[model samples]
Target chain A: MDNNSKLTNLHMDAIREVGNIGTGNAATALSRLLGRTVDMDVPVAEFVPIYDVAAHYGSPETYVCAVLVRTEEEFSCSLIFMIEEEKAAILADLIIPMDISGMDEETRLQIRDSALSEQGNIILGAFLNALSQITGWVLPTTTPAVARDMLGSIMDLVASMFGVIGESAMLVKTSLHIKGLDDELGGTVIMIPDPGSLEALLSKLGVL
Target chain B: MTQPIHVGMADLVVSKHPATLVTLGLGSCIGLVIYDQASKTAGMVHIMLPDSREAKNLPKPGKFADTAVPLLLEELAKLGVNKSQLRAKMAGGAQMFSMPGKADSAIFGVGSRNVEATTKLLAASGIRLVASDTGGSKGRSVEFSTETMKFIVKTLGTGTKEL
Candidate 1:
């Protein structure tokens, strides 16, 4: 490999390490929230063409629920927590003591919305906390926003918001699985540093 | 043979009869289509931004509304399509996420601005926009068939519609 390729590999490794730490913390938070053991896969970090983000997860038309939270001021990044809509309902049922199926439609929706939002907030908070500890950077995140839609549609917004600065995006991803549950209960978390923020992040880590 | 052409984000494609140009999962992004019925030719661009002024001078003209519209027309012109003979149909540009009390800000208005830019440019170019399914809180996938001259849109939980 050339020097550039070698440097890219090192950078990717550093990013993956960051993801591992962040997701590990996030999995712990989920485990506490659900009272179930949460297992996390080793994180992956790489640069991807912005256009291919949706297809990277699955078919672009796949219906999914996503919660996006962004860090404002100082170091910037957007973190998206996504799971199948059906799976998110399962998650909500697991958290809410009452059986959601017994409730009216509006009440069930309210409960589900609050449950999912809180889970998103906690998971993202834990991940950001880990990163702040490592980089000593203040990462105040925006209120988490949730959207349920096709993967492609959600990613289109993400790509547009991030694609303003470059043709490619750096994505750090990890999969979280609740122990004893089927794989369908798992969800993925993706962290994308805002354009120009990756360099600052790497510098903070002494990896650049 | 009927073929399907896939248009990715910030990309554009043009095809003649017996082809369907499809772009999937558009949220806050406009899928701009220009077609000539007589020639059975159509071009579609998945536009991400409203303008290209802020982007570096690269050749990816389909990434922004200001650039993609003219670029699509130029490509169609090469296919023997006259600007005056073209009609437009578009879908997408939906605000996919809204936070409480933040819906009125510019950050949440990208979808509308994208729709506005494309419409203004199309009007200036004299292309009559005959059909559209443009704003809402949902994401849309669109398929434009050159053979049938139909713009079919699909969204989650919602049935398909022909615009």
Candidate 2:
């Protein structure tokens, strides 16, 4: 966003702290759902060119299951929860205790989709709630939408929203890791505040 | 020793024979390619939105359908490629996220709108649209080679297609 030059090191540190607190709350909510310990990595808050956002996350062409939720009205931001497609199946298994090995393929797939969507709703809700409590800004999010596609496509679509007004995006990313799992089924949460919202956010923090 | 020039979102590039132009992960965005077969000169643009007039800022020309088409033509013109001989092919503009009952949302159905705007622009510019793949709920990655005049479209879970 254009306000990048206006943001100082203090503003960035405050944003990172906000990310840490929000994601820390989300980790607790996720752990409650999966009945396992969930650990969060230190959040990364940086400004990345719109063109390189996908590459910064990972290989652009790799397939990922993503859940997207956009803030309504005031904040004008979005949150994308991304996990590997293969890992999504494991995520569904942990959330739903019923044995689906005997069910038909279609039914199993439907259940899996529902499980994933519910997981997204819970995690994103927790994160937003924490942000709202901290910022005292009414940040209501839209219904979550899920898609499994190439990360490049997903990220570029999001980047385009930022590109409309600016050349780069300020991304706050936090990775969630499930404890005691040989293969991690955790996902990454990316928060993108829209062009004007960043300035508004910083002003709310009295940093602008 | 040909290298493929990568086009990012809201970006455009022009190249000559043996040089491939590629754009990845297009969702609600159009990837338009215009090429002159004789000179083997080609231009590719990743258009994010449909119109520039509605944008708040003076966005890059490559970011909108209305502006990108003309800019692509002008770029090709600089390479000594005639507009009369230019043929167009495109892929992408897919609705990545489905928002139920939120038709008024800004991004809702943007894929089809982008496709419509690009099609109208190409027709108005007198460039023949040879082929296209648009209006789906899936994202696409496209590659165009000026040498072979081949446009390859790839998607996850679905096999690749040559347009």
Candidate 3:
């Protein structure tokens, strides 16, 4: 293989390691927040064409609850925590632990939705914290932007925002499930490192 | 039976009524839709950048406003769309992230830049921009119907709106 190809592989590997560490920390945070242990599948990280990210998790049209954090650095990146909307409602039930039988529609929505939004922030913040520790990089992230929307639209914004650097995105991904909860209640976490950061990140990883 | 032509990122297409044209998920990128109501010919370009010069003069005209606008107008002309009859509608120029204390930084300003470029080019091409749903912190799905000349924008929290 060419030296460039070899280096690309190393970069991808370093990002996968980032996912493992970041997601592990995120899982711990979720466990503490929900008062239930959280576990994750192996994290997957790679460079993907802008169009393919939505398909990475499932259908593009899947209704997802997301917390989006835009990281600003010389090597910038965006981190996202997502769960299916219905599953997020279930998680909200856990966070609020209240009956909605007598609540008004607006009140019910406010309670459940806010819980999910807070969860998104907590999990993503944990991931970022872990990333900063390992890379020794001061990664400043944006205020969490929360959404319950089609996955495609969210991914699109990520692509356009990062496309300032290039067409392809480097994604570090991991899947999460709450311990003792049905596996179906779980969701995915993703990170897209800016194209400009690729070289610096690769070099920091250093031929490993 | 008819199907809407789908335009992906950095792509463009032209179509007629009873057939729709669509592009999904426009963040900082602009979806420039133009049509001649009289001739019923419409075109859409999913442009990712403001200037062709930024792309190092690559041949992907549809990828930049400076290049895409002229090329799209040329394609529409080939379809018999009169230059004087063309009008424009645009959507999807959202700044997805906010920068801290550096509001004027170009780092996250692609969305605003895209909107500005599209507007400028439409004017220079002599096409009047009749409507636009642009700017803000949200992404949008856009569909243009050549029949009624409606630009439909769909967002997550705001529901669907027509311009």
Each prediction's RMSD over C-alphas, in Å, is 2.6, 2.2, 3.2
Please report how far candidate 3 places residue B66 from its true position, in Å.
2.2
TM-score for all models, in order of appearance: 0.93, 0.92, 0.86
Q: Sort by lDDT, best first: what order?
A: 1, 2, 3
lDDT of 3 by residue, B1-163 (tens): 3577888777889876566888876767788998989878899998877876644335457878888999999999888878998999999877655545644456467778889989998898889999999988777889888788899999876899999
**lDDT for each residue of candidate 1 in B1-163, tens digit (9 for 90 to 100):** 3668899888889987878899988998999899999999999999988877776554578888998998999999999987789999999989988877667545567888899999999999999999999989999989998878999999888889998
Instruction: Please give, for residues A116-146, the per-residue lDDT of candidate 3 as tens digits.
Output: 7688888988998988888788877677767
Q: Using TM-score as the measure, which candidate wins? A: 1
Error of 3 at A3 (Å): 13
Of the pair 1 and 3, which is ahead by lDDT?
1
Chain B vs. true chain B: TM-score per candidate:
0.95, 0.95, 0.94
Prediction-by-prediction clash tally: 0, 1, 0
Q: Cα lDDT for residue A195, model 3?
A: 56
Kindly report the docking quality category of candidate 2: medium
Enumerate the candidates' DockQ scores in order: 0.69, 0.57, 0.35
Model 2, residue A146: distance off in Å is 0.2
For candidate 2, write residues B91-129 as lDDT tens digits. Answer: 988888887876436656677888999999999999999
Candidate 1 error regions (>4 Å): A1-7, A182-184, B101-108
- In order of TM-score, best first, we have 1, 2, 3
Residues A1-208, model 1: lDDT tens digits: 1112434777878889999999999999999999999999999887777778788889988889888888867887888899999899898788888766877988987788888988999999899999999999899988989998999988876677655665666789999998877655899999978776777888889988
